[model samples]
Target: MGQVHQHVHIEWRGGTCRVKWWSGEYHANGRKRYESKGGFTDEDEAVTHGLDKLYEIRHGTHVSNRDGATLMTDWIDAWLGSLDHACTTERNYRSITNRHIRPFFARKTVSEVDVIAYRAFKKHMKRTLPSSYGNAVMILGMILDDAVPRLIKTSPVERTKRRGKYVKTHTRERKKDVAPETVERLARNAEILLGYQGYVLVWTMAVTGMRPGELYGLTRHYCYPFWPASDPQQDPKEADRYKDDKERYGRDGNRLPAIRVERQVQFGDGKREFFPPKYASYRTLVIPPFLAEMLARLLALHDYDWVFPARMGGCLGSANFSEDYWKSISDGCPERKGPRIRRPLPALPAVPDFKGKRMYLLRHGHKAWLDEDGHSRFAVESRMGHEVPGVEGTYSSVTVAMERAIMTTLQERWDVAAKDGWGTPNG
Candidate 1:
C-alpha cells in the first residue's frame, strides 16, 4: 500500500508571499507531484491559494506545477497521442492544432493560459473564414478541456462574459437540405451517366439518409430483410446475433426489409479502409419494398460481399465517388442535348439547385422527406443514425409503426420515380 502524504508550505520574501504544496500523489514513474502559485502580496492570500491547491489534490483534480513545465506544443502532441479519437477525427484535430493553435500558444506553459490570452487567440482566429475559424477554435477548446487535471488546473476556453453577457467563440452552421424531386432528377441522370451503380446509389442515399462513408462500407452480409428482436442498443454481440438469424423473416407479413448500418469506409493513415461508423452510428433502417427487391437483384448479380464496390473492385472511397462519378453526372447533365449515349433522355433539364451542391445533400433530402411526412423527431433522428439527445433519446426505440411509416413514404417516392422511367436500361 502507498503512504498518504499532503502538506502546504508558505514562505515570505521581499514584500511578497509564495505558497507551495506536495499533492500526496505519485506519477506512473513514482515521483511526488508538487505544485506552487506565487505573486501574493498578502499572507492571507498565499494561505488561501495553498489551501485551494490542497483541496484540488485531495479531490484528484490536481495539476502539478512542475509537470506542466513542458511547452504548449509538447503538451499538445502528448495530449493528442493519449486520445482515443477515430483516425479521421485525430487527423483533423492534429491539422487544426498544428496549423492554428500551436503557432499562437506553442511556447506558453499550460498553467499560464487564462481567459484574456484565449480571447486574443480567438481574435487571431477570426482572420480566417468562418468555417475554418470555428473548427480551429473548437479544436483548441477541446484540447484545453482535456488539459485540465493533467496539464493545467482549469480550462481557459470555457464560456466567458463580455460587457456582462456571455459570448461564444464558434458557431456551427446548419446543414442545407434540397427537395426530394431534385434527388429523383439526379438519380435519373446518374443512371444515364454511370448505369445501375449510380442509379441505386443516388436513390438509396436520397431515401435512407445514410452518410457517404456508411454507404460506401455497406456489405451484403449486413443487410437483413427481417426485423431484429434483440435490442441493438445493448451490445455488439447481441446485434450481430440478431442480424445473422434469417428465420425472423415473414413472421410479420407486413414487416419490411431492414439494412444495418455497422461500418464506414474512411481515409486515414495514408490509406482508405472500412471502420465502424462515426460515433457508433450502428442502427437498422427499414427499406421500402422496391429498394429491397433492387438490392436483392444487385446482390444476386455481383455475388460479392461488398454491396457497392469500386469499378476496379474493393470499397469505393469518397474521392473516387465524388470526383469521378458525382461530378461527372452533375456537371455533364446540363450538356448532352442530342440523342447521344444510347438514347435521348427526354431533353435533360439543367438543375440549378444541384450546381455546387455535394453528394451529402441527398441525405439531407431524406430527412426533409421524413419531416414532410410528419415523422416524429425521435423516429427521424434514429433512422438518420443520430442520437436524439436528452431523456427522449434514452427512452426512445424505433417502433414498428415508425418504421412502417418511413417505408411507406419511401415506397411512394419509388412508385412515382418508376412511373417517370427511372432506372430504365435505355433512356
Candidate 2:
C-alpha cells in the first residue's frame, strides 16, 4: 500500500486484439517488486485482472503466476535452503534429490505436475530404482506439502504411496545380523590386524549398541564407572556424570559402568563436523565390568580428549577407518609394491555366502542379543536410542531392575569373551 504503479497496453495481432498489463509493487522498506502478464483478448478484462492482482498484493494474499511456473529444480534448491535440518540429513536429501528427482522432474512447472505425471514418476522409480523409491517419494511429498497453500492448489503425490504402500512382489536385501560368537571372532581378527585399539572398538560396539559415530564421538570425560551410594569411595568425576543416571536408577549403586553419548561426528563439505546423534539418538550406555576395566586402563594410557583416536590424534573418519583399517582386517591387505604387499586373512570362522559384512552388523548383533535375553521392548528401544512408538514410548519409564537385567545379560557375554581371550586389558 506504500506506493502502487500500474500500466495497461494493447496490441493488434493478425485480425485479433491482445492486451497486457504491469503492476509495480513497493511497500515500506521492501524492494520494489514488479509483475506483468500478457495475451488477453480484451483490454477491459486485462485491466480488471491486473487490478485484482495488485489488490491481492497489497492485501498480502498475492499468488504469483511466475511462482506457479517455477521449475522443479529451482524450487528444490529453494526448499533445501529453507530447511534447518542436521548436516547429515541435508547431505542425504541433497544427494537423493539431485541424483534421482531432478533428472525427471526438473523441467516441469510446479503447477503442471498432476497425478498422471506423479504416477508415472512413481512407476519409473519402482521399476528402475526400487531401493530408493520410498525415500525419493517421501522427499517429493514433503516439498509438495509445503507448496500446496502457497504455489499449487493440490499435491499429486499418491495417498497410498505417501502412506508407505509397497507391492507384494518387491523385496529388499536385509542386512544380516551376526551372532555374538561371530562378533568375538571379528574382534580377535581386528586385534591381529589393527592392534588392541581395533579389538576394543569392535568389542565395545558389539556389547554397548553404540552407533559408529557415537563410538567415535566418545571421550574419556563421558565414561562412568558404577558409583553406588552404598560405596563410600568413588571417582568424583564419574559420580558427577552419573548423577542423573543414578537418580533414575534409584541410587542403589548396583548399576553397571556406563558411557554418556553426547554427540556424533559426520562427514560433509570435505570435512568432519560434530553434530548431535542422528534422530537425536542420545542416551547413556552401561557396560559390563570387564569392558569397563579395559576402557579405564586404555584411558589412563593417553591424555587425548577422544577415547578412540586415529593414528594422528584426531577423531577417526568413518570412511578412512573402513577403507584402511576395517577392510584390511576383514579381508586382507591389498597387493602393493613395497612392504605393504597383500597379506593372507587370518582363519576366522566363515559364515556361508557372507559378502563383506560392514562394522554396523555388530550394532545389529547387539540389538539381537538384547532381544534374545528377553528384555522389555521399551528397555531395548531405550538402550538402542529408538523411540518405542505409540503410548508405550510416551509413558514407559526405564527402571533400575530393567537396567540391572541388561547389565547381567551383557556380563554373560563378557565372561565368554574373557575365556576366548578377546576383551582382556592387555589384549
Candidate 3:
C-alpha cells in the first residue's frame, strides 16, 4: 500500500497567518487514490481537494500534475480561439475535434499519450471519418506541440508513416470541381447581380486560384506600383516570380517587385476583421491583362484600398456575386418557376455540381477547356489552386507566368466580353 499523501492549506488565525496540510485517500473503480500528506485548517476543505485529485486519478488520469493539464478538447478551443480562425475553419476544427480527438483522449494526460494511443485513435476515427484523419492527427499534433516545453512534459506527436492507414475510405461527398459552365453563367450574371466588384472577387480567385483569404488581402499599393521611399523594388513580386520567392520586404534602401498578401478578413467566431494565412499559403500572383483590367476599373471606383470589398455595401457590396450571390439568384429566378433551373456542368476542380442553377460550374469548366487548349498542367494547378505534386510527391512551385496563364485561360473560356478589355494598366 502506498503511503497517504498530504495537501497544503492556508488560513489566518488570531491575526496571524497559519498553514495547514491534509492527508487522505480516495477510492474509485476499485482502486486506491492517495493525496499528498498533511493537516489542513479544516477537514472539509482538505477532503474536497483530496477527493477531486483522486477522482481524476481513478478515472485514468495519470502522469505528474495531471489535474491542471488541458485535455485535447481544451487545447483545441484555446488554439482555434487564439488564432481567430475563419468561420469555415473554426467549424471544421470543432467538427474534427469533437468527432475525432475528444471521445478518445478527453481524460488522458498529455504526458501519458503516445504514438500507439494516437494510432488507435486514428483507426477509430477512420471508421467513419476520411482517410484525411491523418491530416487531422497532424493538426492535433501541432496544438499539443505548441503547449509543450512550456506547460507540459512533451508533445507525443512524432514522425509516423501513417497516411492512408485508416480503416475507412472517402468518396467525393462535396464538389471537387467548381464546374466550368457554372462559371460561365455566373460571369454573365455578374453584370446584373452585384456588378464589377463582385465579379472581380470571383473572377480573381477563379483566374488566380488564390485562396480566398489571399484574395481578400489584395491592396492598391501592391497592384498599382506605389513605392515607399524606404523600399522601391518591393512590388515586383506582384508577378509572383518563383516558388522560393517571398514578398519583397524592406530591402537595401530599394524596393523590388512584390505583392503583399499578408492579411485578409475571414468569417470566424465573430467575423474576424483580418487574419493570417496557413503555412505555404501566403502568396501573391502575377496579374494577367484581363484580370488586371478588371482590377484597374475596380480600383478606380473604391476609396479604401481593397478591390473585392465595398463592405459598407459601398458601390457594389449588395451587387457582388459570390456563392451567396449565385445561390440567391439561382433559387429566385422567375424562369426557374417554369424549368427546374438545370445548372448542367463539366468537372472543374474543387467546385461542386448545381445541376444548372448556381454558377461555380464555370470555374471548373474553364479549367477543362484550358487543358484541351494546350495549357500546361502546372498552369491549370495554379489557376485551380490545386496542389502540384513533384518528383518525390512534394508540391510544385508557383510562379508569376503560371498565375498569369491561369487568368489568360479563364478569360478565353469565360471572360468573353472582358477579353477585349484585357491589358496592364501601364500597357
Candidate 4:
C-alpha cells in the first residue's frame, strides 16, 4: 500500500495543499516512483483522486503517465505494424490513416482523445468525407482498441443508440438486382458495342456471379472441358484421381465443364498483379452445356492468355472496362459514323433500371436466381463462394446432385432465352 502526502507552501497569504501517491513501482536505479497531481485546495479531494489511481493500478486498468502521453500517430504506427493483412487491405488502411486519422489527431496523445474529441472527429468526417466515414471510423476504432492498457485505458469510439436500437449513422444506397430479361437486353447491347466477347462477358457474369476481378483474370488453363488435356499446366495426378469418380464425371461417363476461380487481378500502388480470390474463396464453378459451347466458340476465336481481354489485348482493368465497355452497354450510345461511309453505326437502346448502376449487381442477381430456384442453402452459398456460418456450414457439403440441378436449371433458362432470340449470335 502507498500513502498520499500533503505539501504546504508558505509563499501565499494562508497556504496551499497538494498530494502525491505511489503504488510500489520501482525505477531501474531502485528509486521510488510516484504519480502526482497538484492544485487541489481541499485535501479530501486530493485523497479521493489518489485512491482512484490506486484502485485503477490494482485492477490492472491503469494508464501510466508515459503510456498516456503516447501520441496517436505513434500508436497507429505500432498497431498497423503488428497486423498481417492482405496487400490491398494494408494499402487501404494506410491510405485511410494518412488521409483522415493522422491529420485530425496530429500531436494529440492517446489519453487526450476523449469522447468529445472523438465525436467531433466523427462529425467532421461525416461532413467532409461521407463515403469514407464509416471505414475511417472502423479503422480508427481498431487502432485505438489495440492500444488498451498500454497506450490508453479505453477506446472512445462507441455505437450510437436510437429508439432502443443501434444503427449506422451513415448508410449507402443499396444496389438492386436486374431481371433475367434485363440481363439478356444488356448482353444484346454489349454485343453491338463490344462484339461477341462483350456479349459472352455479360452472360458469363449474369450466370456465374464471378467478381469482376476474377472474370478479368480468368485464363485458358482454368477453363475446364476446353482446357487441353495435354497442356503442361494440367496436373496429371489430380486428373487421374478424379478420372474414375462417377459423381464428378457424371453417370454418362462425361466430364463436367467448369471454371476454376483461383486468382483475381489486383491493382495496388499503380501496379497490376495476380492475387488469390477475395477471402481465398478458390472454387470450381460448374457451367451448363450451352455456356460451355459458348466458351468453346470464344476460345476458338482467340489464343490469348486471358479468356477476356480488352480491345488492346490486355487484362481488362475494372475502371477502364466500366467506362469504355459497361457504360456504353448500360446507358446507350448515340449512332456514329464508321470509317467506311456505308457502315455507319446505329443507336443502341439503354436497358431499363440499369443506368448509373455497377456491374457487381449481376453477382447479386445470380444469387437471387439461385434462391428463387429453391436450391439448397449449402449449394447456393458454395456456388457464390460464400461461407455459410454456424454448424450448418460445418456439417453440410455440396453434392453431385446440387451441381447437376444447378446446371440443368441454367440450361433451361438459356433455352427459354434462346427461344426468345436472345441467345449469343452464331452460338
Candidate 5:
C-alpha cells in the first residue's frame, strides 16, 4: 500500500477557512510536483483537514484509477477460461468482450461501471452491432453480478434496459439465418446416411425451440428417456434441479420432470469447447414430449455422443462446422453445379438454387410459430435462450411445464411447416 503525508499551514483565500496541503503522489516522473491549495486559518486546523483529504486521496480509490486492469477485466478472463464451450463462443467473448466492453470498461472496477456508463456503452453498441450490443450488456451485467460483492463496488449496468427503437439497420435485420423452412430442407437435403442426424438436429431445435448453443453443449450422458422409475441419472436431476426452490416441490413438494442443458457449442476462437449455456438454459433445457422421445432415441442409438459427429467423432468446432457448409448433412440433399445448394446462413436469406436453405431458418420459423400461438413472450423467450422483453414476472410466472409447452408448439409448427414445404411456396 502507498503512504500519505499532509502538512497544514494557515492561509487566507477569499476570506475563508482554507488549508494548504498536498495529497496523493508528491511528484510525477517529470518535473511536475504535487499540487498545493493555499489559504488556511491555522496550522493545526490545516493539518487535521489535510490528513483527512490525504487519506481520501491515497486510500479513496479514484474513479479514474479503477479504469486500469480491475476486477471486471479479471473476471471476464476467469469466466472465459473456465468455459467448456465451443470455439465460436470463446471467440465471441474475446471479440465482443475484449474489443468492445473490455477496452471501454476494463479500466472501470465493477463498481465503476455505473448506469450512466452502461447507457453510454449501450448506445455505442447499438451503433456498431445492435444485437451483439444488447448481448454484451447482458454479459456485462452477468459478469458483474457475481463480482460486485467481491470487489466491493456497485454494478452500474444492473437492471438496466434499453427502450425505444432498436438501432439495427433494416438490411442487417434481414440478414440472419433464413426462415425455418429453408433450414429444414437444408437438413433434409444433406442426406447423410446417419439416420436423419442432420434432420433431427434441425428438427429438434425447431421442435424443442432450444438454442443452437444448447444443442452444441449437449453430451451423450445428459440425454435419457424420462422413465419415472429409479434410474441413476433421471431421478437425481429432478431432486437437485429444484434445489433452488424454497418449497422444493411446491405445495406438494413436487416438480415436473427435469431436463438438463449444461453446455453450448459456440463458434469462437477458431475452435469449440462445451461452454455454459448463455442463460439458465445452460443448466436445463425443458423439452416437449416428442422431443424427449426423439432426443432419447438419438442418444441411445448414437450412444450419447455428439448428436452430429464430425468425421473424427470428437467435439466439432461450431465455427468450422458452419464454415465447412455442413449445415445439412442428410442423404436427401444433393449438390448440383457448384454450391451444395444449402450453406449455413449468415446473410438475410434468399431462395436457394436447389430448394434447401440453411439450418437456422427452422429456429426462426419456430420463434414465429410460438409468437403467433399467443404463448407468453417470456415462455417463448426462455425456450429461445434469450432475455425476455419487459421486466415483468418472467422470472416467476413461467413454469418448466410452460417452457415445455413452448417447445411443443415449436415442434408442432416445424412438423406442419416441413410437410407444407417450410412455409414456402413449393408444390
Candidate 6:
C-alpha cells in the first residue's frame, strides 16, 4: 500500500491550495525502499499515481529516478568499455561518441533523454552531419537501448515505420560502374602519370574488384603462384589439400592463377598495420593469365616486399595516394609551369566517365562485368568477397566451371582491349 498527503505552509504568501505528494514503500534484498513523486494539485490524482507506482514495483517494472539520473556520458563510457568490437570498429565508435554523442548530451541525464530530446538530436545530426547522420543515430540507439530498465524504463528511439511499412530516412545511391574500355583508358592514364606500377594498379583493381586497402597491402608472398604455399594465414589443412592436388589434373584443372586475400592495410594511431579483410572475408581470387603475367613482371622489377610500393617507398597512404596519384589519373592533370621545371609537363587526358569519381568505382565495375557475363549469383558474390545471406551462402559454393568461365571472359576482354591499341606496358 502507498500514502498520499498534502503539506501546508503557514508562511505562504500567494497560493491558496497546497500541493499534494505521493510515496510507496517496497522491500528488496532484506531492505525497505521508498519511491515518491510530488507536485500534484488534487488529492485523488496523487493517490492514483501512488497506487500505479506501487503496482509497477510489484510487477518488477519500476525504474528508479536516482538510477536514471546517471549522466549519458558516463553510460556511454561504460557501454563502450563493455563492447569487444574489432580495432577499426572500436575506433569508429569512440570517434563518433567523442565527436557527436558526448558533445550533444554531455549535461543531460539518461532519463532526461525523452522522445522530444531525441528528435531534437536527430534534427541536429541531420543538419550538421548529414553524411554521418545515419551512423550517429544507430550508435545513439545502441547506447540507449543497452540501458533498458536499469537506467531508464525504455529507449526513446523508435524504428521508422509508417502504417506497418518500414521507412528509410535516406535513399542509397547506386554505385557507378566503369566500362572495360574506360578501364583501359584509366590504366593508360595512370601509366602516363605515375609509371607502370600505377597502370598495373588500375588494371588489377578493375579486373579483380579488390578493395584499396587489400591492394595496398598486397605483398609478393600473397601474389599469384606464390600464394597458398607462402600464405602464413592459410589454414594448414587447406594448404595440405592444395599441395596434394598440385600434381593432379581434373576436367577443368587449376589453369587460372590465384591471389590470397588474407589481410588489408590499416592506418591507425599514426602507424600502419595489417588487419584481416573487411568482415574477415579471407578468400582466394582466380585471375586471368594476362594478369598473372603482369604481376610476375612487376615482381621481377621490384625487390621490395610490397608489390605496389609508394614512389618514395613504403606502403601507399590513402590521402597522399588519392591526391598525388588517383586524382591526376582519374581527372586529367593540367600542364603546369613551375620554377624547377626543365620542360613543361604535358596535360594528361582524363578517363571518360571517371571525372571526380572514386577508385572504388572500379570494384563496382568488375562486379558489373561479372553480372553482365551471366555468371551465377553465388559465384559472383563469392568472387566479390560478399556474403550472401541465408541458406544460399551456406549450401552454394563457387565451382571450377564458374572460375573457368570468369577467367575466359576476362582474358577475352584484355585481348579485345589489346587489339584496340591499348597493349600491355613494355616494362
Q: Give the Å error, residue 17, model 3.
A: 40
Better of 1 and 6 by lDDT: 6
User: What residue runs in model 4 are displaced by over 4 Å at the alpha carbon?
Assistant: 1-35, 40-55, 162-177, 227-252, 336-346, 419-427
| Per-residue lDDT value at 137 in model 6 | 89
Q: Select the stronger candidate by lDDT from 5 and 6.
A: 6
What residue runs in model 3 are displaced by over 4 Å at the alpha carbon?
A: 1-168, 173-181, 224-260, 267-271, 314-324, 329-411, 414-427
RMSD of 5: 10.1
TM-score of each: 0.76, 0.75, 0.49, 0.82, 0.51, 0.82
lDDT of 1 by residue, 1-427 (tens): 1112235677767777778777786778999766667787976777777888788777988767666676788888887888788878888888888888998997798777778888788778776645578788788888888887788778888564545446574565455556556776777667665556567778778778899998888877666432344224446757655664333332256556777787898988878888888888887788887778666666665665667766445677745777766775555444445646554443344556776567887787788889988998999998888888899989987777888888898888767646555544452
**Backbone steric clashes in candidate 4, count:** 0
Candidate that beats the other on TM-score, 2 or 6, i.e. the better one: 6
Residue-level lDDT of model 6, residues 227-277, one tens digit each, is 645556446767665663343212135545777787898777668888889
Better of 1 and 6 by TM-score: 6
Worst 10 residues of 4 by lDDT: 4-13
lDDT of 4 by residue, 148-194 (tens): 87777878877654233454565666766567688888888887766
Q: Give the range where candidate 2 is weakest over 10 consecutive residues by summed lDDT.
A: 225-234
Candidate 6 least-lDDT 10 residues: 8-17
| Candidate 5: tens digits of C-alpha lDDT, residues 109-199 | 5655667877888778878887686668777776666554445345565453357665443353243434556555555543232234545
Please list the C-alpha lDDT of all candidates, in the order they appear. 0.72, 0.71, 0.52, 0.77, 0.54, 0.76
Candidate 3 lands at a TM-score of 0.49
Minimal lDDT window, size 10, model 3 = 249-258
The order by descending TM-score is: 6, 4, 1, 2, 5, 3
Could you tell me the lDDT of residue 197 within candidate 6?
74
What is the lDDT for 77 in model 6?
Answer: 88
